[model samples]
Target: MAEEVKLFGIWGSPFSRKVEIALKMKGVEYEYIEEELGNMSPLLLKYNPIHKKVPVLVHNGKPIAESVIIIEYIDETWKHNPILPQDPYERAVARFWAKFIDEKCLPALWNSTWSKGKDREAAIEEASQHLNTLENELKDKKFFGGEEIGLVDIVASFVGFWFGALQEVSGLELLTEEKVPKLCKWSYEFVNHSVIKENLPSRDKLVAYLSARFADASK
Candidate 1:
């Protein structure tokens, strides 16, 4: 029997959008359930009781949490437009970068935006160093997986879809082409790609959302 697929996520969440993009790349049909973060639904609560986070993937009544893990599950299950590399070593490298992006780059980017003065500068330098490392890894490739959007691409959604909006929100110039030309180009290409372009939240909307949060945090 063909399994049913359902995804619960909020509109402005890049992590949630990562799952959407992964499913699109794999050509998997799913019911997209928009969750209200302030008033999370019982279904989301039930499935992800531990984290109570969005981007929960439920396939054949089984639930998977976390965007990267869900994308990996989708890659394994669908098997058509694959995300990970076939060879063990390449897959390991992909996983390493994915985790690095998540653990190191993402936090540094967010902190750079959320902090002030010297702290912000330090965060920007840290984020830039991480991006430079990724830039060297990418070299001249169009995508992280060398011609295809893969796991690393999914995890790097912050760069693809939200960097500009976050820049507006934080009033910072972090991911400019002058700073990281190749990564900047990849971000534009990834955002405008046919597969997941329509799924993106409006840049203005994200700016508004994050700006409000910054204001509240500043007060």
Candidate 2:
């Protein structure tokens, strides 16, 4: 019998989308359960008691939380269309970029979008530096991991999908044709991939959701 697989996620979460992308890329079949982040379901809480975050993958009654971890688990378990490089050195490089994006880039971007005044400016500068580093890194390669999309690509996929929506909501544009030509092109390619394109949330809806979130946070 095929093992039962299910995913608990919020539609607007980039983290959730990351896992979804990995699952799709690996051709894994699973049930998707959309959850409200504000009022998380009991099942989600039960599955991830520590964080209570979404994008929890339940396979054969075992729960796995955290988006990147879930992606790694999916890749290792399925092993059909590999997301990580096979070469040891190349794998380390891919993991490094993925960690950089997850830790440095994401936090800076979120700070820029969600904060105000000098703090926001500082966040923007930090995020710009990260983008500059990524631009330099991608100067020679087509994708972050080289010729094909790999772990780094999956980790950085939010730059294409959610980043633009956040920029629209926050009234700031980080990735532009003139500012980061290669990144802009890469973003287009990443988001336009059939699986990603089909799975992304509507831009208008995301903007409204983010705007509401900002308003609520301010109050």
Candidate 3:
């Protein structure tokens, strides 16, 4: 019998899309199940009881939750296209940046869009700092993984696609070419990469979606 692979995800979620991108990069054939995040399905709940989040990957009968974990699992399982560095130290560095992107940068970036007054200012400041950190790290590299897309590039995929969309919807500017030119350039390169371009949600649709959501949240 053939091994079964299924991914439960939402269309607009970067986290979910990142997993999909990884799958595509590895030439992994899997079923894509779109989920309505607002209405959680029992299957999703069963697969990920703790988070009840999208981007759950089920291989055979086993389930994996969280996009990062799922991505690493896919990398390990496929082994055709290496997502992380082979060198131990390089791999560790990649992991560190990936964690930073998820835990620190994304939160600040998101808050900068929705927050107001002092909080908004603070968020923008913190987000800028985080972006600068990335800018320095990516100074001369074609990709975060150096010559090719790797763990850090995959993890920071949101900044490439959603950053502009979120900024447009919120009428905020966190990532400007003038401010962080290198990172901005990286964003352009990453999103325009053949594989990533194919998997990206339409920018106009994303802006429209986020506009309504942010409008409601503000009220």
> What is each predicted model's overall lDDT from 0 to 1?
0.88, 0.87, 0.91
What are the TM-scores, per candidate, against the unseen true structure? 0.94, 0.95, 0.98
Top lDDT hit: 3
lDDT of 2 by residue, 132-153 (tens): 8888888867777677778888
Error of model 3, residue 13, in angstroms:
0.5
All candidates in order of lDDT, best leading: 3, 1, 2
Candidate 1 lDDT at 53 equals 90
Ten contiguous residues minimizing lDDT sum, candidate 2:
140-149
Tens-place lDDT per residue, model 3, 1-219, is 998999999999999999999999999889999999789889999999999989899999899999889988998898888998888898889889999999999999999988899999999999999999999999799899998899899899888889889988888776899898999889989999999999989988888899889989989
What would the TM-score be for candidate 2 when compared with the true structure? 0.95
The segments of candidate 3 whose C-alpha lies over 4 angstroms from its true place after superposition are none
lDDT of 1 by residue, 1-219 (tens): 877999999999989999988888888889999999889999999999999999899999999999999988998988898899999999999999999999998999888888888998899889878878888888999999888888998899887778778887777886888878999889888888888687788888888898899899999
Best by TM-score: 3
RMSD of each: 1.4, 1.4, 0.9
Candidate 3 yields a Cα-based lDDT of 0.91
| Residue-pair clashes per candidate | 0, 0, 0
